[model samples]
Target: MAIKFKSLPRKNPQDLVAPEKFYASAVGDGEVTMDSLAEMISYQCTVTEADCYAVLISLEKNIVSELAQGRIVKLGRLGNFQIGISSDGMITPEEVNASSITKTRINFRPGKKLRLLLNDLSFKKVG
Candidate 1:
């Protein structure tokens, strides 16, 4: 299926009044729940829905734990998940410390398989 997108006007940073151009933004139709995901996985493999659901739950928990410990978690061909931080820069390297960190966010770098899959995706315009 084609990914749907909508046209959105973005204001220029220099000139706030005039819009730079209309950009294509994704419009999500709806969310697919965990149950749906499990069912879909079960249909394509020998694994049952219950087993898939359990694996998914365990995967989520382990990923979170690893990220919390400032470790990168790689899920085989899926991708690598890591904790990225935004921090205030210091003039001297010695002055910088953990306290300088302002925010921490989860970063996902898609693996080759995922990138390949995205290359075959089609797009559709939405209202």
Candidate 2:
């Protein structure tokens, strides 16, 4: 299936007076719920839907636990999940500490399999 996208007009940040340009923006079709994912996985494997769901829940909990310990969680073909932080700048190196941290975010770097999937995607322009 092709990914759907629509043209969106956006003004240049550097030259606002210039004519706006249209860019392709991906439109989401819909969301797949956890239950739907479990069912799909069950169909593809020998596991039951309940077992798949239980494993998915455990995976979620364990990923959180591992990340909380300041370690990167690597899921083979899926990729790696790590904590990233943005911080306020300090004049002196010695002055910089935990208090300088402004925000923390989870970062996901897709693995080779996902990257290959992106390369193979077909896009369709929508209204």
Candidate 3:
């Protein structure tokens, strides 16, 4: 199977006066929910679907807990999850504090397995 994409018109950020160019944007087919994932995992292993789901839930909770503690969570061969923040600039270092933070988000860095998968992916253009 190939990843599907569609051409989208986008203007150049550096030159607003420039004509818009078409770029390939990925089109998602669908999403796999936690329940579906657990069922699929159960089929691949000896564990029951309920047990797989419970473990997945616990994994989600623990990942969040670790990030809350200002630590990176690493899932072997999966990737790393880290907390990222954007803050208002202050003239002096002393002026900066938690209140300066304007945004917080979780960042994911794919591991080698994902990277390799990316290297081998084929794309199909769709209308």
Ranking by TM-score: 3, 1, 2
**Residue 90 shift from truth in candidate 1, angstroms:** 2.0
For model 2, residues 80-117, the per-residue Cα lDDT tens digits are 99999999999999989999999999999999999899
Model 2 CA deviation exceeding 4 Å by range: 9-22
| Local accuracy of candidate 3 as per-residue lDDT tens digits, 1-127 | 9999999999999999999999999999899999999999999999999999999999999999999999999998899999999999999999999999999999999999898999899999999
- TM-score comparison, 2 vs 3, better candidate: 3
Instruction: Please give the distance, in angstroms, between residue 120's alpha carbon in candidate 2 and its true position after superposition.
Output: 1.1
Error of 3 at 107 (Å): 0.8
Candidate with the greatest TM-score versus the true structure: 3
lDDT of 1 by residue, 33-64 (tens): 88899999999999999999999889899999
After TM-score superposition, what is the CA distance of residue 101 in candidate 1 from its true location, in Å?
1.7
- Runs in model 3 deviating more than 4 A are 13-17
Alpha-carbon shift of residue 15 in model 3 (angstroms): 4.7
Q: What is the C-alpha lDDT of each candidate?
A: 0.91, 0.97, 0.97
- Which residue pairs in model 2 clash with each other? none
Greater TM-score among 1 and 3 belongs to 3
TM-scores of the models, in the given order? Answer: 0.84, 0.83, 0.86
